[model samples]
Target chain A: MTLVKVYVNYKKSILNPEAQAIHSALNRLGYSNISDVKLGKYFEITVDDDSKDIDSEINEICDKLLANVNMESYRYEIVEGANA
Target chain B: MTLVKVYVNYKKSILNPEAQAIHSALNRLGYSNISDVKLGKYFEITVDDDSKDIDSEINEICDKLLANVNMESYRYEIVEGANA
Candidate 1:
């Protein structure tokens, strides 16, 4: 088995409503200095073995589907593992 | 300033199409053993210095905005920083 970790986020230049909401929530919770907020996500994927050159294949996936080139940024790391 | 990191992910029980695409990419790239894939994202936010009890404030923000209790999960870490 192969383990992959992916990180995706909105580009810095874009406005994020979700982040803004988070900022207000922080304000209500009592933090006065929290002028801004940005939200992000993380994921782990486990793949079964059917191919040979896994890393390159995964990078292709990132380039094509896992990431949106227009507004989001993403990076992935691979960790070889013992599983199905 | 306060540095906040949020990690949001789909529950294990959920189906992730992004992850599925990544899996195929890995297969194409040469990792034959990779049968499945899951995608996730990460974000870093800087909050200005204005509140006391920053940790609790950030936690509340997480509960309200950064995380989705129904399908996605989130966790945050605060790093005291040398900036506004």
Candidate 2:
């Protein structure tokens, strides 16, 4: 099996209220050193080894289901032996 | 500035309904090669340069706010020059 790690996050132009809230909360909790915070989605997908063109398949999956594509962008990395 | 990437996920013993839902959706979408899916939260935190002992500070933050230590576990990587 091949393990793919995907990260989906809001575009740079978008204002993430959740991240802002977290930053404020961190400040309230006395972590004043935190300058910024960004919240995103992470997915670990395991695919069968028989598949061909894993890169295209992963991109298609991300585009179709994982990421919104309009306001969010995604990136992925494939690990050859990530059965664990 | 330092960029810390934090990944928070449910422990192996915990049941992840969201991941299961996604897996089902993928199967419905005809991605039969997919074997498993795991979903989690990803955070990008930028910290001020003046902070001393960044490792300990990040650990404290993760323990106190970023993750629920009981059901979820978190790991982080510090990227020194990640201003972009």
Candidate 3:
């Protein structure tokens, strides 16, 4: 079995409302030193080892349905011999 | 500086299409056995260490901006004296 982990996040240059809200809250809470608040996301997938096309599958998913390539960036890794 | 690491992901029970694509990819890659694929996200925020009220700030951010609370799940940890 192959274990794949994906991490997705807003582009660094893009404006994130969530981070801004967090910044505002932190400022109000007297933790004003918080410079920047960025939001990120992740995913862990377990796949059957019988197929050897995980990368293409992941690419298609990212391109078609999983993420908005224009706004979010993602990376993933496949683990070998893990939980096999 | 306080390092706050947040991990946001689809609730464990949610259906993840990204993972499914990867699952198919693995099967094509010749290393099948993967059962499911899930997508997740992360955020690493740096807050001013001088403030003792980071918890509230984080909470508000999570509720109002950082996470949807309705579909995604998130968690964060704040470090003390690590980068001071």
Candidate 4:
């Protein structure tokens, strides 16, 4: 099997309220130097190693469902082994 | 500065419906070979380098607010630079 690790996060140009809240919380917790506390989604997908067009398929899935193209961006890396 | 990367995910013993839904969607999209699609949260926290007890502080923040201990587990790593 192949392990596809995907990380999806809000675009840098966009405003993320959840991230702001977390940043504020960090400050309140006496971590004044803490900054850029962004939040994102991570997915660990396991797939058959023999599949053809795996890269494109992963791109399609991520673009169509895993991430919002306008506000969020996604990237993925494939690992040779599977721990799924 | 210190960059704390935290990954929070549902316990392996628990059922995650969101992950299942995404898996089904992947199958419908002709990725029948895809399996073990698990979802999780990724946080990129930027903090000061001079702080003492950084490890325990990160643990406190993660445990108290970043993760739901009953259903999820969290792990973190600290990088040596700043990208906040």
Model 1 chain A: lowest-lDDT 10 consecutive positions: A34-43
Fnat of all models, as shown: 0.83, 0.90, 0.92, 0.86
Error of 3 at B82 (Å): 11
- Give lDDT tens digits, candidate 3, residues A38-70: 766676766666655779876765665456789
Instruction: Show the lowest summed lDDT stretch of 10 residues, model 1 chain B.
Output: B34-43
Off by over 4 Å in 1: A24-30, A49-52, A80-84, B13-33, B39-41, B49-52, B80-84
Per-residue lDDT of A5 in model 4: 92
Clashing pairs in 2: none
Clashing residue pair totals per candidate (backbone < 3 A):
37, 0, 39, 0
Please tell me which model should have the higher lDDT, number 2 or number 3: 2
lDDT value, candidate 1, whole model: 0.67
Please say which candidate is ahead in TM-score: 2 or 3: 2
Tens digits of per-residue lDDT for model 1 on B1-45? 677776777777878777686567666866566566655556576
Candidate 3 TM-score for chain A:
0.80
Error of 4 at A63 (Å): 0.9
Q: Could you estimate the TM-score for every candidate?
A: 0.67, 0.97, 0.61, 0.94
Task: Give the poorly placed runs of model 3, Cα more than 4 Å off.
Answer: B1-3, B9-34, B39-41, B49-84
The digit string of per-residue lDDT tens for model 3 on B15-76 reads 77875775677567543454766656577778766666888777776666667888888888
lDDT string for model 2 (A1-84, tens) is: 999999999999999999999999999999898999999999999999989899999999999999999999999999997765
DockQ of 3: 0.50
Candidates sorted on TM-score, descending? 2, 4, 1, 3
- Runs of candidate 4 exceeding 4 Å displacement: none
* lDDT for B67 (candidate 1): 58
Per-residue accuracy of model 4 over A1-84 as CA lDDT, tens digit each: 899999999999999999899899879977786766989999999988778888998999988999999999999999977666
Q: How do these models rank on DockQ, best leading?
A: 2, 4, 1, 3
